[model samples]
Target: MPKESYNVIGVMSGTSLDGIDLAHVVFEVSDGNWTFDIEESQTISYSDAWLQKLKIAVNFHKDELEKLNSDYTILLGETIRGFIEKHGIGNLDAVCSHGHTILHQPHNGFTLQIGNLPKIAKIAGQKVICDFRVEDVALGGQGAPLVPIGDRILFSDYDYCLNLGGFSNVSFENHGLRLAFDISPVNTVLNFYANRLGFEYDDKGKLAESGKIDHELLSSLNNLAYYRQSFPKSLGFEFVKNTVLPLIESFDVSDIDKLRTFTEHIAVQIASALPKKSGKLLATGGGAYNRFLISRMQEQLPQIKIEIPEKKILEFKEALIFALLGVLKMRNETNVLASVTGAKRDHSSGKSYEN
Candidate 1:
């Protein structure tokens, strides 16, 4: 018989490098319907050493990355163990981790997410289900925007589910198929410029609001080739490093103007990508908290109703969905959707380790 409920911890480290988000979630299935409760949650910020290593780890040679992977697994295991002990969280069926992404160029037929070493289960003293994206890539898919499965199952009430994290992505049903893809870079770019001004983030986009938009910069950003690409695509730190940052830097605009112009670009692109029909849009992730960005999106997408959930859901939805992914893996059910990722077919993708 299938289990009706599962208690799991979902750990996520986004490309934005904001922190590692951990959520103790309970998933329950009643009458073929699913529901989840985030019992406990918190984000553990990375130390300067770890942050610097991860930021530049992409530039490391193959051998260097392998060594860093080993070290990162240890750090990830330790961090998860700390969270478990601090919360006194018991009855954990497994720990589901979306390890920090180092390289995500699926077009090249490979992707790497660190911290999924088998030793993690030993260190955390729990079964671990992780490395969820590798198999999809092997199947010739982009292996990204994996959270759409959760949107389809857990939060189906809304017509569209949009996440504004390091990058912006949206998931929605179209003609009975779930479709999703990355829209544009978000905190990854905004926070970079914010750091230049000595702030961690723009703090509700106050800096952007204080500045004027640079039309030339905005036009250049909107015309980028990625924006013209079709679905089954995703963006990564590499895209920002190779495409976004250099383009932004080439323009002679104040930091504030750059921020503002980029913010507008984000709004315009998101609005353009959204479905034309009116429907509810559930917006979450860190960027949802950016009042200025949301306002700009609203102006561009007046037809679509935007809904921001409670604080817990806003900040930890990705972690919560990773927990759902774990639960699906435990049940031997498909957790990744081929329609969304362009994989050969739907499949359950994760490596399971017994402690």
Candidate 2:
């Protein structure tokens, strides 16, 4: 498709395992200026059973996972069709999906996102674009943090753009190149603790306020090996289930103290990722709802300004970015950042399917 002729739906399910976000967007390129319209958007929360299945997706055996992959694609197709009907979207150029990230162990040179292709086309009766990370990872990159390209193109005004979803990643252009990576796990770790107290998440960080910070735990978590790793890296659900949970368990502490300490750890790491200059830092995702986490970030470093946009923007920014990614892929433009993921070179990485 030509740059001037593109309209897409970008689907995204983050590592948070929160839900699927779908956006019907119209992208246009005129006189080399890229623009977009978010026509409609909605989130489809996972059912208890689906949540449980996806929670353990990182641990599924190969054959079982392969089956679930196709099944999940069918499930997504149904959801997307319902979204289209609900919003009265028509003449969609394509549905661009960032299939759920199941495993991201780039060191072992492997990553997986399981949403079958042909099954999706069969079910949706529409062209689809998915499986966006493997190509970059195969080319010696962290098959993750692929959002910076969107940030660079669509949200170029911000000095720093930070996403506080399942993981914390900041994007910014430096030295004539865009730099981004997984800074730390945000909602993934916080939501885990909050769930123990019969809450889905620490809404506005109220639970965290009731909890006391364990300085020792805070120090220990801040010193994790992953934090010391260089850029072009990412985190996985398995890493959290295997590495993070065990490390927290080793302390044998209460959930409150765990939340308190972890919030501080997040603050330290996030503050460190800020550029050594003064500018506005846009914060988004579910973590923005965690007031306690935001407070810790402010207390740790008052130099950087953490600006949260409108509610819809905070919730659907990733979904919106994915929509833009689809626009780029459709135009055969580079959506992956070489400076961020250390890919052999910048490139557009996705496989598109036609119905």
Candidate 3:
């Protein structure tokens, strides 16, 4: 008989460079339905040195990138080990990790996530399931927004699941098919501007709320070509570094105004991407805390009701989903949705190493 439950640790690092999130979770199945309990969770802030290295890793040469990948694997292993020790956690089925993304160009048929080497299982002293996106890319998919499957299974109460993470992405059902795509850049761009102002992030979007909106800059941002593209699409730091940053930097506005304008852009993009009918929209990820941004979004889509979950889900939802992804892989069940990622077919993804 198959196991009815799994205890796992999920690890993730987003493009925003906010930090690495670790969640200890237990998933159980009953009557073909799934539920989870978040046992423990923490976010370990990255050091200045590591933040710089990861930020520039996309520009690294092949050799340098290989070394960086190896070092990152070690760092991730040590981090997971520490979390386990701190919680005195034992009997984990696996440690599921979405390593930091260095390069994500699914259109070019490649996406690289560091810290997924097989040795991580040995270092962390547990079985591991990771490198979840590579296979989907190999099958001609965007290799992103992998959380929708979890949304479908564990959070079906809502009509939409909007994740305001490093990048904003949404998942929902349309005509019996699960559809999802990246809405726009969220914290990935907001945090960059905030860092320039000597703050890690715009607390409650207070700085943005105080600044004036640059309508011209906002218009240009709204007209970007990516917004017009259809579903099964995604964005990465490359798009932000090459396209978004350059466009935003070309303006002479103050950083505060830039923040204000960009926050409006995010709100507009999110509203435009969502269906305009009355429904429940479950918003999660770090951006949910941005009161100003949420207010703008709510104003734009008056019919949609946005629900902010508890602190654990708001912060560690991605990590929690990755834990579920690991459990599915252990059971050889479909974890990545072909409809969401535009893959060749629905399939079980990720590489598993039993230590």
| Clashes per model (N, Cα, C within 3 A) | 0, 0, 0
Q: What number of backbone clashes does candidate 3 have, counting pairs of residues 3 or more apart or in separate chains?
A: 0
TM-score of 3: 0.99
TM-score for each predicted model, relative to the true structure: 0.99, 0.97, 0.99
Candidate 2, residues 1-355, lDDT tens digits: the string is 3748677888899888889998887777787677777778888999999999988878789998888888888889999888988888889888888888787877778988877466786577778888888888899998778889888877788888899999999899888899998888888999999999889998888888888888888888788898888787788877788778898989978998888778888999988777664777888988888888889888866877889988767888888888787777877988888899988998898888888
Candidate 2 Cα errors over 4 Å, as ranges: none
| lDDT of candidate 3 over 4-65, digit per residue (tens) | 98999999999888899999999999888998999999999999999999988889999999
Error of 2 at 187 (Å): 1.0
Weakest lDDT window of 10 consecutive positions for candidate 3: 269-278
| Evaluation by lDDT, superior candidate among 2 and 3 | 3
Which residue window of length 10 is worst by lDDT in model 2? 116-125
| Model 2 lDDT at residue 57 | 76
Clashing pairs in 2: none
Cα RMSD, each candidate: 0.8, 1.4, 0.8
lDDT scores in order: 0.94, 0.84, 0.94
lDDT of 1 by residue, 108-184 (tens): 99899999999999988899999999999999899998999999999899999999999999999989999999999
